[model samples]
Structures are given as structure tokens and as C-alpha cells.
Target: MAKNNRTLLLIIFLLGIFIGALDTGIVSPARTVIASQLSISSSSSVWIVTIYTLAYAVSMPIAGKFSDRYGKKKVFTLSIALFGIGSLLCGVSNYAGSFSFLLAARVIQALGGGGIMPVATAYIGESFPIEKRGSALGLVGAIYGVSTTLGPTVGSALLNLVGNSNWGVLFLINVPICIGVIITALIVKDEGIVKEPKKMDVLGSIIVTLLILALMYALTNLQFHDFKNSIASTKVWPYLLAFIILLPIFIIVERKSLDPILNLKYFTNREIALTLLISFITGAGMMGIVFVPQFGENALKLKTGSGGYLVTLMAIFSGISAPLGGRLVDKYSPKLVLSMGFASTLIGSSTLAFIVAKNPSFISLLIGLAFIGLGMGFCMGTPLNYLMQTNVDPSETASAQSTLSLIRSIGVAISPNILIGFISEAGKNISPKLMTILPKVTIPGSNTAVSMTQGGSSSISPDQLAALQNADVTTITDVLKQFSGSMIDKFSPMLKQQLQNSKLPKGVTADTLVAQWKSDYLAQIDAIRSSIENMFQSTLNEGFAKLFIGAAAIALLGLIFTLLLSRKTKPVSSN
Candidate 1:
């Protein structure tokens, strides 16, 4: 009876991990809405998102060791409490406050919530036998999938629920759940403190934390502020230089630390090392797929709220593919399961480029996204099992697994940032096009086009207004396409010229014309979109091809790592 109850408790605590994960995607859908109403930039709210994950990245490995020393239950309880605090703070932040405050609070929230997963994994593995491990791991993955799916939906629902009460409600809602998760964690007892030669290395932890954080900041920011253009700027130089300096320090410190945050000994083992590398390699390309739907809807001229559905369609495929791959891993071989998953994504990315080359249909997204999602699900979990079985004794499965879990996490952070670097590199040649007609273009903040405020002419009849609106949509789209294509075609030269000149047009007199240009730019977006919508299928097909080409190329890297795997993989043993 006690054992069964512990299982229930651990399962409940695992839900808390998704509380943080949900926040990752939750703020994503609501970003534009929140940023607009707050009179701030989308760039501001995006930090509300990327920063949390960034903070979480630095916090995870630290959390695991703290759990090891202090006890999982204590770490678990503290994490939820902090998560609740962070959520409440976020919900209440108003127009009067600063964005920096929110980021600071998120980092604190990260410090608090980081240990929940590693600790939860630590405890659950101790409670369950090896026979039950795979299923238990699957349950955890399922929970994550459910959390990620529900994140956007919940975010959307909360936005509506509060009815412009603002994004505070999304944060506020987590408060109650965190309260509940905490109570359950407190009721659970601590278990296992197997004394080994290893000791938790505090200095090593700090070095690794700094190293990862610097690298993460460097990668995520690279696209937004490219090194190519602004290589000399402090933003690029400071972070990148710090990363370069600290990385060698981290590796050296880890070698000497009594308990290295990362166990380098594993690097000597070909199978374990290679499989983990495969995980990281394949993950590198997936970063964009997660956010592509948002870009497609918000930036690419698709209607709002449509982005989530587009993402959902792809997720549906991945969700379906993962379980099928799981079964294959169980029945056939982990090698085949992983290799096929990587291959499927490669094909899917290639197909996606073609589908998205034009402004494609929502249904097409369903097919392409499903294929990739399925492939990911099939391959994701079995790698951890390989890590668990191959490293350490049977008695140390949980510890070994938690160590690998931390590595998987570092990969997750590193991979997306790498892909962001790639995707941004792809768009380096691309440019944001004007969307609407010039004469009608209502420079956003100004009132010129009916597109901005609607019904440009007070003297015009209703029928005329309707006709104007129809024509305006097409005109806006045409201008936008031409402008965008021009931006891409001449981005390199244009940027270079702009840097050299660094001057606005003759009439413009402002510190930052870029901001004003954005408004006009957004308003003008329709001009280019009509053409895009007409050629949607072909355009998306092209986009899909480009995206897959990258995903596949990266997966082939993963495939090479898999080739380094041993001749035989261990099957799922009996429970």
C-alpha cells in the first residue's frame, strides 16, 4: 500500500515539471496579444518566454545534485513553491513595471523549479523496478506531450477567460496548481542516499552553469543580433567571448571536481556517447519547427489563432509517430527505431520545404508535421534507457539515468539555439516585405489605410468601402511580396549600405526609424500576401523543402552517430 501511494505521489510531482514546460509554450501564443496591449514590443514578451527556458537550462543540473544532497522531497517542495511565486508575480505585473523585473522573477522561478524533474526522476526510479522503468518513462513523456499540447490552448483560454484582464491570469492559474503539487510533495517521504566515491562538486556546478548560460544567450541572441553585421558590438562580443573563455574552464574544472556535473567517463563508451550525441544532433533542427507555425501565422500573414492549429497539426503527427516508434523500439530494435525516426524527419523536412514554398493550406501542415512528430516520438525515449542500462550497476539505474537526463537537457537547450542560428542564417538573405498598398498604407500609429482603422473614406458609400477593402487586400499583398523579396534578394547589400550610410530619408527625424518602419511594414504586409496566398501551396512546398533539407541533413548527422552504436541493443526486459 505504501509503495502504491509513493508511485501516485511521484506521478503527481512529475506534473509540476510540465507546469514550467507549459509556461514555455503558454506565453508563446499569447505573446503578440500581450505585447500589444501592454504597449510594449513582441520582442519584450518573447523574453518572458525564452528567458524562462534559459533560466531553466542553467537550473536543471544544479537542481539534480541539490536533490541528491538535500533530499528529493525537499527539493520538490521548494521548486513548486517558487514556481507558484513566479506565476503570481507574472500575473500581477502591470504597465507601470519594467520587463527586467519579469525576467529577474523568471530566473528566480527557475532556481526554485529546476529540481522537480531530476528529483522526481531520482525518486521514481528508486521506487519502481527496472521491469517497470520503460513504461514509467513513457508515462512521463506522455505527461510532457500532454503539457506541451495543453500549454498554448491553456494560454489562449486564459487570455479569453480574463477577457483582457491581461496575461496575468495565465500566471495566476499556475499558483493554485503549484500549491497542490507542493502539498503532495511534502506528504511524500525521502528515500535513497547511496554513498559512493562521488561528491557533488559545487565549483564545477557553478562553472557549468555559467558556461551553459553564456552559450545559450550567445546562441539565442545570435540571430536577433547577428555577429555578421554587429560583430564588434558589446552584445555579441561580451557573451561569445565569455562563452569561449568559460568553456575550457568548465571542462578543466569538471575533470578535477570530485563530482563533475557531467561525468566525462561516459565519453569513453562508444555506444552511450554516440546515442546521446545522436539525441543532440537530431534535436538541432527541431527548434524551428516548434516556432515555425507562429512565424507563419503572425509574420507570414496568416490570421492569428491559426498559428496554434498549424503547430497542433504538426504535433499531432509527432505525437502519433512517437508511440509507434516506441512500440518498434520495444519489438524490433532501438537501432531501427532511432534510425527510422531520424530518417522520417529528414524526409518530412524536405517535404515541408516544398509544401511551405508557397502559402500552403492548414491541412498540408497536418500531414508534414505529423510525420516529423511521429518520428521524434519513436526515437526520443529509448536513448535514455540505453544510458540507464549500459552505465552503472542495476542498483544505480536511477542515478545514471538522472545524469543522462541532465545531458539530454543540455542538448535540448544547445540544439534549439544552434537551429535558431541556422534558421536566422537562412533568413539573413530574406527581408520583411511591406504588406499593403502605398497610397492606402496607414503607417501603424498613423491613420491612412482602412486596413489599420478600417473605412478610409468617410465620404464613400458602404458598397464603395467594401470594394475598396477587397482591392486593398490584394494591393497590400502585392506590395508586401515585392518588398519582402527585394529585402531577401538584396538584404546583404542593403544592410551593408545602411550601415555605411546609417541615415534616414530626408524628411525622417527620429532616433529610431526602425520602430516606425515596423508599423508601416506591418500595415503594408497585406500587399505581398495575396500573391503569397495564391501560390501558398508551392511556396510552402518550397519552404518545407528548405526546412526538411536542414532537418534531414542534421538527422543524417544523428544517423552517423547511431552507426557508432553497438551491433546489438538491449530489448525491454520483463516487468
Candidate 2:
């Protein structure tokens, strides 16, 4: 490969990853605005974000292997065009008020965006020389870090410009940028030249996709359960069972197929196995960091914008740390650097766990959140370096990097389900009784918990009850919830007074006992809310600490495993 050509491929590869990362986080904030405008519930609108992830997660490995059979340029250009089309479709669909159509548009975007990542990453791994692979991958990781950090703030700000209702404008904005990339891609020539005798693995692709869908669905339900709805209860099992049935079939077909969407043999390689595992763990860790905003809310009760900034803090730290870690991998061993990255995450996570309650500056939280990002940055660069060290053939670089990308996506793919499951488990331990009795509760939302109902009381005669009974739908829940809460508080005193007039159970009046019971209920309810927050907060903190610590540990493990590669070092093939 010529030097100039390699540089050009690198530019295109970076663009692809940057664009893909930008899309991943951009939808999170404005999704709520989009939901109401389209007359759909938030749950339905969630797909607008989820479909992108699912598409990317399932399609990456397939796209990676596809680059080998068809030329890399062809696959890369097609991916860009598809993503651009998806983006264009989003802008046009807003006119029809069709959420389903909008969803389909999202799917198209996902399909395109999903294909872009692996191919782009693969292009980097293959085009960059062996010695410079770590730095090359680090550069890609850095761009991703910057784009991700900028996602929410950028997306929200953009929405403001387009009238928040113009959410489609975000998608439409991609078209021109994508067109530029595609035109550039067409001018670029294919870099990874191999004999064209290999066949595509059609059945393996189908099965792997099915398996990913099943896993993604099962995990998503677990992470982001609908506590109010019971349908969520039965949603997980079929997918889990189907995944169980499908995985083995996928393994068998891939092992036997002339060509597989995923090459099963790669897993047999120590570095490949370890790299994929690292990617998976990092992905999970990424999800946990994403929730730092929630912690800011639940524990500290900060404002909307304030809580969301926690994630922004993390992105900033991770973005900076990723390139630094990549340099470490280049200068030192992958193991030491990866371990440090993981350690940072663990420390940050542990710190977040001890938080009980007290409003802190959003800056302090950002500082803490930055460490989580730092840890992620430290870890993400490992697989690219590791894959380069492990794979014997230059042509296999695409598969290795692509597979790592896919596995890492597993963390994301499973995040909604993972966090949902964590919340559910935590919720079960939390007595719902607290929810009914607490002074106020935060609705399902940002880091800061807000009062679900107001504390104000109306002063009106008994005649008002009849009049308020037929109030508008908007006031019904607020009135009913608040009225019920106040009535519960006031009921004991009124009932006790009435019982006194009736001459209750002699020395053991039921009304007096009832008053005590209500008092106890209030106490218990307050305790429940406090305990719930504490329990989940501690658990998540501890879990995150361990997760980061594990990332470091995994890095160490990778270091040791990398030693094994040294023992049987695969000579870098001369370009």
C-alpha cells in the first residue's frame, strides 16, 4: 500500500467512526420532545434510539466479513450511502405524523450506521502499518470520544435551533456530510488486496443476526423494564430461550461454512478471544457510566440539565484518556495501560457509590464522572493493538477489529436490559410502600429526582369535592395522587375525633390505634425511599467500582496473555 493511499483510507476510516459515534448518543435528549410531537408514548419513541444500537450491534460483524469478499471501498461507500439515506428519510417522514414510518426510517439509518463502524475500524487496522496500529486505533477512539461527549449537548442545542419539534432536522443534517464522505470514498481505491475465491456465508449471517436480535431484545427488557406495565414481565423469556436455541446452531454453521459472518476459528486465537472479551466488558462499563446522570438525580436531586452533565463529564475524560492510553500501548505493553484504565473506572465507580444525599456542584460530579471516561479511554484502545499482535494474516485484520467492535457492542446491546434488571432487582427490595408515602418522588427521568406531586393543598368547602370530581384529565392524576396522599395524612385525626364521639372500644379505641398505624406507615414509607436509594446506590457504586477494577485486571490479564503471543510471536508480514 502506498503512503498517501494509507493516509487517505485513515481519514475516511476516522470519519466513519466519528459519524457513527455522533449518531449513537445524539438521540438521547430530544427523544422525549420527539415522542409528544408525534403523539406517541416515550416507550415507542425509545426505538428511535434503540434501533440504531441494535442495527449497529447486529450488523457490525457481518459488515466486517463482507469487506473481505467485496472490496473494502465498495462496502464502505455503500454503508455511508445507506446511513445518509436513513438520515434523509428522517427529515421527510416528519410531515406525515407517522411514528411507524419514522421508526422504519430509523431502521434504515441504523442499517447504514451499523455497517459503517466495523468497516471503518477494519480499514484502520488493515491500512495502518503494524507498528503504528495502536496509535491509528487510538486516533479513531479519540474521535469517537469527542463525538460521544458532544452528542447530547450538541443534539439538544441543535433541537433548539430547529424548534424542538424539528427533531428530524438532526437526521437530515447528516446527508450532506455523508455525501461528502461517499464522494471521497469513491475516489479512494481498495487497500486490502486478496484472492477473490472466498464465498459469502449466507446462512451463518442469518443465524448470527437472529441470535443477536434475540439477545438484544432479552437484555433490553431486563435493563429498561416498564414498572407500570406487566407486559414487561413476560417479554424476556422467549428471546432468551430463542437465543439459547440459536447460538449453538450459529456456532455450528460458522464452524462448518466455507465463509462465515463471523469466523469461529478466530475465537480460538488467544488474543482474539481476549480482545472480544475486553470489548464486551468495556461495553458494559460504558453503559454504567451513561447512568451516572441518574445517580446525580436519585441521590442528589439535582435539576434536569445539571444531572445530564454527569455523562458529559465522563465523555470528556474518556475522550482525553483514550489517546493517552493508546500511546501507552505503543510505548509500553498493552497490559499495563489497559489495567490502569480499568483501575480508574473502578475508583470512580466506588466514589459514586458512597454518595448518600446532598446537593453538590455539577462540576464536582463532572470531575468524578471524568474518571469513568478516563478508565474507558484507557481500555478501548487495547483490542486494536491486541488484534494486530495476534492475527497472522493482514487480511484477517478486518475480521478481528470488526469482531471486537461487535462484541463491544454487546455491552450496549444489553445495556437497557442490564440497567433495567438492576433497577428491577433494586425495586423489589425497595418497598413500593415508600413510593406511596414519601413526601414526593422523582418521576422516571434524569439524575435529579423531582416531586411527582405537589405539596400544596386547596382550601375549599365540602361542595368543591363534587365539582373537582369531573375535572379535566390533565389534573386528574395530580389531584388524585395528591388528594389521596393528603387524605391519608388527615384521615386518622378526623376518624379518631369521630370515634371519640361514638365511644369506641372502651379503653382500647380502634381510632387511636389506627392513628398510630398511620404514623408507623409514614415512618416506614420514608424509610423505604431512603433505603431504596441507599441500597441501589451502594450496589451500583460497588458494582461499578468492581467493574472498573476488573477492567484494570482484564488489562493485566491481557498483558499476561500478550506474553503468550510473544512466546509464539507471529512475524509482522511485510507490506
lDDT of every model, 2 decimals: 0.59, 0.64
Tens-place lDDT digits, model 2, residues 50-128 = 6767777777777767776676678778888988998888888777788888888888888877777666766675565
How would you encode candidate 1's per-residue C-alpha lDDT over 1-575 as one tens digit per residue? 28767765766766775786677668766777767766678667778767776777777766665665566667678878888898777766744355666677777777766666656655654555544544455445545554665578678877777775466677777888888877776776656554353566878878877877777766556543354765566655787899899888888987888766666665666666676576566546555466555445633456545566666665566566555554554455567767777777766665565654444455565566676676666555544454345344433343345556555665555555444544444332222111232334333233544342243334344653343233222243553434433333333344345534655567654424544554455444554455544443233234334555666788777777776676565532211
- Candidate 2 has what TM-score? 0.75
Q: Each model's number of backbone clashes?
A: 55, 10
Instruction: Give the Å shift of residue 144 in candidate 2.
Output: 1.5
Residue 362, candidate 2: C-alpha displacement in angstroms: 5.9
**The 10-residue segment with the lowest total lDDT in model 2:** 467-476
TM-scores for every predicted model: 0.74, 0.75
Worst 10 residues of 1 by lDDT: 428-437
